[model samples]
Target chain A: MNHYIDVRTQIPRARQTINNNNIKTETEGGVPEWAIIELQGLIQMKKEDQSGPTVVGDLHYFSRNRHPVLILGHHVLNGKEVKLEQPMAVIEKDDTTSYKVKAIVKKKLLFKSRPKPIISNVSEKV
Target chain B: MDTCPERSSEDVRKIIKTAKLHESELTEVTQILRFPDPSKQNDNLKLMLLDDNLLKEIEGGNQLIFKGDPDENAVLCTSSKTYDIKEAETSNSLLLVPELLFAASTGLDETIVNKSVEGDSDSSFDKSNTSLNKSADSDDGKPPREIVHKDIISTFFTYYELKPCKPRLSKLIKLLDPTKYRGPELEYAVDKSKLYNYEALFDQIQASKAELDEELIKIQAIKIDDHYRLLEFDYEFRVLSHMLDLIEENSWPLDRISKDVTIDSLKDLVPESILEAMFGFYSSESAVDDGIQYYQYKQDKVCQFLARVLLKSAGKFNLTEFLQAWRDSVPEGMTTDESLLSGIALIDKTTTPQVVWGFAESDLPEDINQRFKVLFQTKAKWTVDEISPYIQLYATEKLNVNALLTKYARASTQDGVRVFSAKHMK
Candidate 1:
């Protein structure tokens, strides 16, 4: 059977590119180039993406400590374009729980000014 | 007119013999015959007459000897008229001679006159010479002067007055020489004793003796434990007991309390833990329960009594009016939902009397009159939470701990949400 897995937990690799006739990995520090590219793509997507209908999905993974973590339902992703409505959950495999986490979402509105009408009747009436 | 004949003849014979004698013999006879009482014609005069006759015979003066005896006892002489013979008795012969002389010559009376003239001549010569000498010396030109008896007496008195009666300063200095005073110490002491009153000097000595006695008494009065004993109990057990009541009434937090709380501050509201600590430490017993029991049962009654006393001493004012007025003036930041909720949370957690006291002393309006104005502000209504930080900042700067506590207590009560209309909130 084909089993589904969370891509967040998978180790990612940098893509090699030719620059000045030399091939080199694009990553800096220990972070993967694909993750940085994805974050930048997401930042750009939020600025340009219009409000529209889209499909949603869920993902699950384990932390380095083998903690049971759950991604909440209904996240929109279109390659570079992604939006989240709720926070992901992290549950340790231990017997006791010490604290809980809550989610927060904020939306800002921008309004445009309408053009004023020309006073063509003023001179004729006067 | 009735002349005696025998006196006259005898006088003639004496003059004839005086004329016959030499000057030297005459002088010798006159000296011998001179009588103190020549007026008596006695037998002594007959002897003088015989000496005069002998002197005349020796000097070779003629002596006509009368041979006719007028009487067998009397000597006789010739008279001018006749050779008269008279028998004169020797007893009465001396008296009859002067009578015979007076009858013989009228010049015999002139002889007494001549004797007075000779006597006055020498005295008059002395008087004139003395007067001439005095006149030549007289400067006043009035007359020859004699010393008046009164002037001589006055001059003697003047000389006595001018005579020195007392010694001079130099003489007194010589008598009291410093070199002599240093010679014998006893003499110096005697002289000094004379200069000062002995009774007063003795009194001074006695006063110094009394002072020494007083000093000894003061030394004896000093006790052994006086130095550090009082310092040991300077803060009494009762002081801690009083502090315990104050801690409970104000709800002071346990962790915040320290022994460093000034006696002046703790006097207002005594803490129970302080009393428990003091009693436990001093009495060597666990006094925690005793302190709690004392506070829970008896301390409240004591505090009420103290509060009544303090209230009586406090100034009179309409508390209702003051509270209402303060409520009205609460700042805008104090009456918001967020500030009010936060204030309530702070008040619930607060354990210290200082925090509660701070709220009680805020200056914000408490009346409903200004409530509408407070509700209109967007930031928040003025409440203790908003004003307290400022009061703490000010009170801390002023270093007034009492004011901080009072303001903290007042502010806690004043914290409340001010509900506003939707239009006003915007």
Candidate 2:
């Protein structure tokens, strides 16, 4: 319980290794690479399928749109790129000295809207 | 395709140059998101969610730490504040995509590859061949080269949320009890553990650095030979009395007491460092003259110390006798108010002699329920204002003093004044 959540060494180093990350412009840079795909309900799958490499969905990014679209099986759900109101620090407690910040996630890929069914309407050639 | 990238948060991308439709630039990239292999899905990653204010402090480069005992729930600490760390569970899967591309990171540059291949995602199928990419034309109508794939390294279903709370500092007193500095002369007599320095105390005490520093000041703890040492009660009272005597001997007005003057006079009597810190405790800075800042001996602080000194010696005294003695003990021209005794001493009229006894708040448990038990044990009943200081430390945004009283103590009007007594009185 007497532990430290060390961010001093991690956060300052993350700033220089920036990959298109811009936080508050004046404050600091963004965290590179990491994001959370926060689904509304549980991404429940069958027990048998859970053991294998399961396909969650396909994320489609379109130019000029604020949010992206995700295709899961027969369902097409629009996902928004949102900054989490309270940013979270991903902590990894290794079996030794202290807890370290693995990554800090500022923005998330939010898939909250009701999924629209991808109804195929292609006309068959005779 | 088998590599897990150079960095932990790397976003690996791959592109397929499928046949292109002329004139329409289909820059859209469809990425297949999948779960990692079941063996790789370890719930080792925990998110310590930060509030906006605390987030700002973190960004400002403050150290965040957590402290607790084995059975107690751990508390997190920033430089200035402490917070209760509560694990919140989410029904939805928190797909921790360390390299998931945000809207801003996915443009112009080829830092990311063709989006069909998920870098950390599951390799159950050939992602490049299943080109959901029907059209493959750049803005220049050129077919792009290749594709890439990546897997999610980890995922989590719960996160640690923080709520600001009073620093749990009662343990500090317990830790320092054995190592009390009874002056340099008596240091060899008692067997003690290797003394706790600031760093050691910080590691042991369940409080933030700034909060802990303030508590040390309030506890009047002084540094002797780099170790934060609490002065023994008798020794501390001796020092306090000497400091008071120096003020009277020099004929210096309370407002004009100089650090240089106190240091020069008390150097042989008390260590200079102890003298300086004690002055800081009993006084507040008023103004600077000739580059020497003067401190007015704080009236309330001095009076409280003197009252504690009187209350401790007598253990318990008839209310009238204790009041007179307390008044006589303080420096002349300074007055003592009963309100100053809020957390220091309690005057009980229920007793036959109506005695006033020392009851320092620092000795009580930091817990809400346990503290109420001790309060009720000390005296059967307490008026609202009398017990507020003792209980007020636990008051948070969701639970204020009145609300806490409602839950823990039964209330009734005693002689037109609201009084609180333990709910299940023994």
Candidate 3:
């Protein structure tokens, strides 16, 4: 039996599927910024079967940006590389959904430190 | 209270001292973190966009300014560019925590903590922290600008974006999952080995197949030979039976028997060695010699068989009756005289003589005298010319006996010729 959920109610699951499929993102929500993107726009895919641009719904995309690229001859992010622009569709908290916008790939000269990875469940021996 | 900043001015100073970043490096670090409303900052900017996530270097030394989130992921960024959080805690950029919000929480906390706990003054900590924040946050008052320096920009984008070049799909697929793309690689490895093992195996199989085929052919040939030999034996038996039948049906004359009974003429009846074994009457001195001994051996066998056949048919034989019978038996193409003589010669040693001549000088003389005595009794005296006809009557062939005639007769001159009369006293 196929249990299908409305995409509106299933954004997190949808996002999980996209992340598992290895699409790139630069957004905090872990989604790209475009309504339709060339399937080739995702770094992980070879050329997908369809020739024209694919709507964000058709794409396997996520805001999780672990996709890798070679930049100035170095592997970054635990030997992973990321591409910043890919198409994504995200459902907001109120169930309103937004498609990705076209983003110009530009240099972010003012780089900030990543937040420390925190382990949550340990107690102090007071 | 929810957005608590955990860093202190003393920690920031420590990072600066470890990295040896100059005052300008400190300013760049401070500016990037001090966007009054941190929540409103661009998401792309907040990404750890540099390879080492170090944004810039201060001029005097190895000090580099790095950026990362400190509390959310606990990356613990430091000014030392090569530091990894999982590997070591020492980093020069550790002080530049984005969560610190260089102006509000961490700065004030450092001032209060310094005054209460240690000999360090609140006034001195406030001076450095406030100066760094003022220079950094005052740059736009509008929004934090994207970095403009080429080296800094290039490093950030290189880490964050894919280059605009195509990569080979086959190579890319292999790189993605090596285990699945195994066919070509396995074949290539097998080909590169020097043994040519598959070819060798094929050759061995072919050789074994050829040997089996040869063995099958040999067996077939042996079977054919055995079959042919049996057929030949059967044919010989048939031919011998036919020859024996031909002999029994015909009253073969002596010469006809002689011609037909030779080993060469009757070869179809039986092999030469089998014929010799059956009817041979003489032993040859040398088996190797196709010479006179072998010829005589064959001739003797033929004559013996004929004599035995003739003797069997008629119980007892006399010369006159045998002569008549042999004359009738002579085959065409041979003279009657020659056939009779050869037959007599063959049977002579085995048979008794027919004519008796007692007290004879020789058979020819005794024969002549006997004929004269009989003629003389018929006529008391006769001319020599009258005796010629009677003398020829007993002679089997022409004989010269004119000189012997004087023993039986007396001669006188009468008219112009001579006449002879038998002497009465002798």
- Please write out the lDDT profile of model 3 over residues B15-52, one tens digit for every residue: 33223222222222221122123333233221222231
Docking quality category of candidate 3 according to DockQ thresholds: incorrect
Chain B TM for prediction 2: 0.77
Model 2's DockQ score: 0.24
Candidate 2 lDDT, B232-333, residue by residue in tens: 878888888888887789887877788788778878988888888777777788888888888788888889888887877647789988889889998887
Candidate 2 local lDDT, A67-108, one digit each (tens): 666655556677788888889877665433345455678888
What candidate 1 gets wrong by more than 4 Å, as runs, is: A1-76, A79-126, B1-274, B277-359, B362-426
lDDT of each: 0.23, 0.67, 0.28
Please give the RMSD to the true structure for each candidate, in Å: 78.3, 9.2, 51.5
Docking class of 2: acceptable
Interface RMSD, per-candidate values to 1 decimal: 99.9, 10.0, 24.5
Better of 1 and 2 by DockQ: 2
Q: In DockQ, how does model 3 score against the reference complex?
A: 0.01
Tens digits of per-residue lDDT, candidate 1, A63-119, equal: 112111111111211121122221111111111111111111111011112212223
Docking quality class, candidate 1: incorrect
List the candidates ranked by lDDT, beginning with the highest.
2, 3, 1
Q: Write the per-residue lDDT of candidate 1 for residues B119-169, one digit (tens) a residue.
A: 733223234235432422322332211111100000000000011111111
